[model samples]
Structures are given as structure tokens and as C-alpha cells.
Target: MIKSLDIVSDLGEGFGSYQIADDDSLLQIVSSANIACGFHAGDPRTMASTVQKCIANNVAIGAHPSFPDRVGFGRRGMDLSALEVETDMLYQIGALNGFAQAFGTKLQHVTPHGKLGNYVVEDSKYANAVAEAIAKFDDSLIIVTLPGELAEAAKKKGLRIAYTIFADRAYNTDGSLVSRNQPGAVLHDIDLITSRVLRMVNEGKVTSITGQDITVKGSSLLLHGDTAGSVQMATKIRDSLIANGIIIKSLNATK
Candidate 1:
């Protein structure tokens, strides 16, 4: 059978007058989108417009919920109770779902944003909270994340899981992503990124920052639209994957 991959990107990360990536261009390249939901970088108008665009481009929409940190772009960590995390996530998901409903589509998945994403990988409490929120909102929604506590919690809750690998980020020896604060954490070279993606999909492995080869599921590949030259890199990676006979699919169609 031919192998399939899901290409996703974070979009709608704009507030009032400030915009972050060329979402329109990136939408054409990605099969799915993790749209920022107010907390990190989106507003009511932006969310509605993004949902419409996703429908227009036939891209699956997923919620990219984050801590209430617009200034830090959800990259900074916040300490909160389990209840707070669960409620916050539910609020964000509900807000985005409203837009999706208005646009005649629904959320295909939920992926934590920035620090919360990292936390879910390391903290079971946060993982459980997130999973509970997703389960309560809609058990059918897929949880897009790396292999970790979140995945485990989602499995326990009977929610579908989509293991994702970052196309523009570096990995650690333990299969976790390297911290963005570290040097070389985010990749920029087009050839190198594409090659890494190919190896991860074809070989189920990626070279870590420590020069060690690590195993990965790579069910989905995430591309950050805000990164420099991200559009070009995404286009090249998609073309290369197709050239090699790998099918590009949406997360909803992966399973």
C-alpha cells in the first residue's frame, strides 16, 4: 500500500492590524490548518475569515489553543490549575467551532499551541486536562500531537490520535523537539528540511541534535507558516514527497 502523510500549518495568527504569515499562500500548500483561537494570535474577525478561507481551499481546520498569552505568542509557560486548563481549552475550542459551524465545516482536530504543546508532552496533568476538554467537547475530534502523555491520555479517552512531526524543527535524542531557544532548533535550509521529512516518512527515523537516529511515527507533518521562507519550503517538500510517490492526505483522511 502507498504511504500517506498529512501536511498541516498554523494559520490565522493575526490580531487587529498585525498579521503573521502569508496564510493565503500557505493554505494552498497545506492540507490542514491549526488556526490560532484568540488566546495566542487570533480575534473574532480573523477567526471567521480564516475558517472561510479553509473552506475555500478545502483544508481541514483544527483548533490551535494556547495559554492566554497574546504578547508572548503562547511561547511562554503559564502555571494553572487543571480546571483552568480544561476550561480554557474548551472555551477556545468552542469559539473556533462556532466559526467553523458558521462556515459550514467542523474542526477535524485539536493541537495545543507552543508552551502548552510542550507541556502536554511532559506533564500528565496538563495532558489529562487537555484530553478531558477534547473528550467533553467532541470525542470524535483527533488529537494531533507527538507521542507522549497527551497521546496516552487521548487514547484512554477514546479520542483519535494523529502523531505529528515538525518539518521545520529539530529533534532531541529522546524524540522530543529541541527547545526553540537553543541554536539550530528551527531549520531553515530547504534541502535539509525536505530530506529530513523524506527520511522520517520513508524510514520512520530522524537524526537528532545529538547526531543520534531516533524513531518517529510521522503520521502528520507540521509546517510553521510564520517561519522564514516557510512557503517555499512547504512547496518544495510537498513536491518532493509527491515525486517520491508518497501521498499527501488530510488528517481527517489519514486513518
Candidate 2:
């Protein structure tokens, strides 16, 4: 079970000033916002606008980088190496950091987009390389990853880690996320998502698809803004956590 409650949102492609319907609502609720860094989604304009909001709310901003597959939306896996993943992540973070500096905010962390995130969690070499990239780019930058393998690997590389659990997403029996290709991967039931987060925050465990409770930590939680009830779900999560006396804060602030 996790010891704290922190919520993050994946802002997707509506970067800069672009508002693709109800985007700003979740910004106020989540403690962090994972803004797209071009390859998967988002543009310079959208990135700039989202940064301003994050600054205003004191929410931490992270680079949600992915393989250069805008057409696949960065969800599908690609043939990428340790070196390739590191460079790609660096490029995206550097781009956003450039705009964030203009708004007087620093890029606080980096989380791999889609398949790359899952990849590094299981592959030690890939994980270390990503961590090395982050350290080389700026050791001060935090890395948000899963609690078990991914978080451990990042920590081994001497990079700051923000252990995270997905709020609106479910994990398989083995702790990997339920693949999107599978029918119940993305949660539409607001009740289910909010309940899962509450369990993670209070119990420090997650009930995998096999109905087995596995120990987990919840340093940071995510709400995929691209998911259908994400805005409403994130709002309810914030309210519920506060109702339970949990503090809603960005990973950096709490750490």
C-alpha cells in the first residue's frame, strides 16, 4: 500500500494554447501534468500554454516522451535501443525545458510514453540507459516509473525516482498494465478508477487482474487525459483523496 496520494494527468497532444474540449478542468485537480513532447502528441503552442497553467497551479511538469511515431500515437512498441531511447527522451525534455524556462518554471521530471515505459521496466540495460540519459541531461530531473522493476532500475542508476501507479489504468496479474488492445484496458467507470486509487493510497497494494493483491507504492498517480472520463475522474479522485485526508501534491514538492 502507498503512504501518500499524488495525482498526475497525461495532457496528450493539445499542447500550447490548444484546448481540445475540457482540457483545463483536470489541470486544477492533478498535482502533475505529463505534457506531450511532439513525437507522440502536442505542439510548441500547446506545450507553452500547459506550462503556464502548471506554473500558476504549482503543479510539476514532466516530459512525456515517446518513439517518433505520431501516427501510432506512441502507443505501439518500436525497435529502439538503450541509446536511442536515451537520446529521444533527452530531445523531448530539452525542447519542453526550453519553453518552460521562458515561463520561469523548470522541468521537474520525465516519464516514458506508451511502450517505452513498459519496455524499460523489464529490460535492465534499457532502464539504466534511460536513467543515464536523465542524469546526463540534468540529474536534478526526476524520473516517474512503476514501483517494482522500473523504479528500482532507475534508482540503481542514481537518478531520482517518483514511484507511480496509473489512476485510470489497470494492471495485469503480473503488474504490467493491461494492454490497450485488450478490451478492459482503459477504465470508463469513474467509480472503478477512483476506488482503485483509494485502495492504492490507503492499502499500499493493488488487486491485479487475477484478483490477487500485490504490494505497491503510490508516490505519484496518473490520469490519462486522453481517456474518456479522465477530466471528471481526476476531479473526483482529488476530492476523494482530500475527503480521506490525503494531501494532493506534485511528486517533487512531496519528495
Candidate 3:
């Protein structure tokens, strides 16, 4: 039986005046926060403020890095050399580290954002580059990724892994996330999502888009703040998980 799980959400994903989620409300609900590091969707001000919130609330903070694409929201894949990917990871992680240090708190983990995140599962070069970069920068920084090349590369690099699943996203039969372009790729119904998460939490499995059962490990569950009713969904999910006997603990706190 699963004793504990981390409830994490993407925070600080806004740039300038454009905001995405209710960071304040979600901060109160989530155990860990994957904050954007200014590449995909956050600016310096946003990152600093988000880190402060995490520190004030005692929520674990993780750096969320992505390709240097702002228009596509880092959802568009970029063709870059392994060195470029590694350096980009280092840059983003370092940027977040500065604010964390100023706030007297260190980042607990690193998770790639958007397309950079999805490619890490199938692209070994990309996955290894990201893993190597994080390990080089700070081996203590946990890597939150699915059970695939990313996790494997991080393991080989002697970094801790926090396997996660998308509570609001669908999965493919091959254990990859269903593309956002696909129909039903993102779930919206609150009751449905809550029930699906409960099963994934307790059974360590989820039904894929092709109607196949795929094994999933959820040391952390990823919730999206950009989605409709996300705050409500997160609150309900956290409450439901506890009601079902699962403890909501950050990955940094769990063994």
C-alpha cells in the first residue's frame, strides 16, 4: 500500500502581466511547487515571488526549466545539441537557485517543462543531457520525471528520482503522456479526475488512451493550475487522497 505521495503543481508560469494560475490558492493546497525559471513562462519577479511564497508556506520548491521558447510556451520542440540542452538546464537551475539562496531556502528538485519535458522520455540524448546537467549543478536536486529514459539517466548520474504522473492529462499505451493536441488528452471533469487519481495512487496503474492498463508510480502527482477549476480540483484531490488513507508529503520529505 502507498503510504504517502507528493502533490505538486506548476507555479510561477506567468510572464509580465500575463498570469496563468491562482498561485496563492494553489500554494495552499500543494505540497510541492514546480516553479518556472523564466524560459517557458516566468520572469525574474515572478520567480522570486513564487520562491518567497513556497518558503513562507513551507512548501518544497523545484525549478522548472524549458526550451528558450516563449511564444510557443515551450510546447514546441527545439532542435539543439546536447551541450546546449545541458547548458540551458544549468542556466535555468542557477537562476532559480539565486532567489532560493536569497530566501534562505534551496531548491528541492528540477523538472523540465513542456516539450523539453516530453522529449526527455523518448530522446536519450536529451534525457541524459538534462540528467547530467542537474547532477553536475547539484546532485542533491531531485529529478521529477516519468519512469523512462529521463529517470534512467538521472539514476545513472546518481541523482534522486521522483516519478510523477499528470493528474489532468491522459497517457498513451506506451506509458508516455498523450499529446496535448489529441482529443481527450487533457481531462476536465472534476469527479472523473479525482477518481482516476485515487486509482493511480492506490493501484499504481492507470488506463491509457488505448484502453490498456499501464503501470504508473506516483512519488509525486502533477496538477496543472492553468486548467479550469484547477484550484478546486487540487483541493478535492488532496482531500480525497487523504480520505483514502494516503498522506500528502513532499518528495523531499519522503524516503
User: Of the candidates shown, which would achieve the greatest lDDT relative to the real structure?
Assistant: 1
What's the TM for model 1?
0.98
TM-score of 2: 0.92
* Clashing pairs in model 3, backbone N/Cα/C closer than 3 A: none
Q: lDDT score of model 1? A: 0.94
- Give the per-residue lDDT of model 3 (tens digit) for 152-244: 998887889988888999999888888999999999999989999999988888999899998888689999999999999999999999998
Question: Which residue ranges in model 2 land beyond 4 Å of their true spot?
Answer: 1-3, 15-21
Candidate 3: lDDT of 190? 96
Ten contiguous residues with the weakest lDDT in model 1: 246-255
Ordered list by TM-score, greatest first: 1, 3, 2
Model 2 CA lDDT for position 20: 48
lDDT tens digits, residue span 186-247, model 2: 77888887888888888877888668887777578878777776777878888888888887
The C-alpha TM-scores of every prediction are 0.98, 0.92, 0.98
CA lDDT scores, all candidates in order: 0.94, 0.80, 0.92
Tell me each candidate's RMSD, in Å, in order: 1.1, 2.3, 1.2
- Residue 15 of candidate 2: its Cα lDDT? 41
Better TM-score candidate (1, 3): 1
Error of 3 at 156 (Å): 1.3
Clashes of 1: 0
Query: How many clashes (backbone N, Cα, C below 3 Å) per candidate?
Result: 0, 10, 0
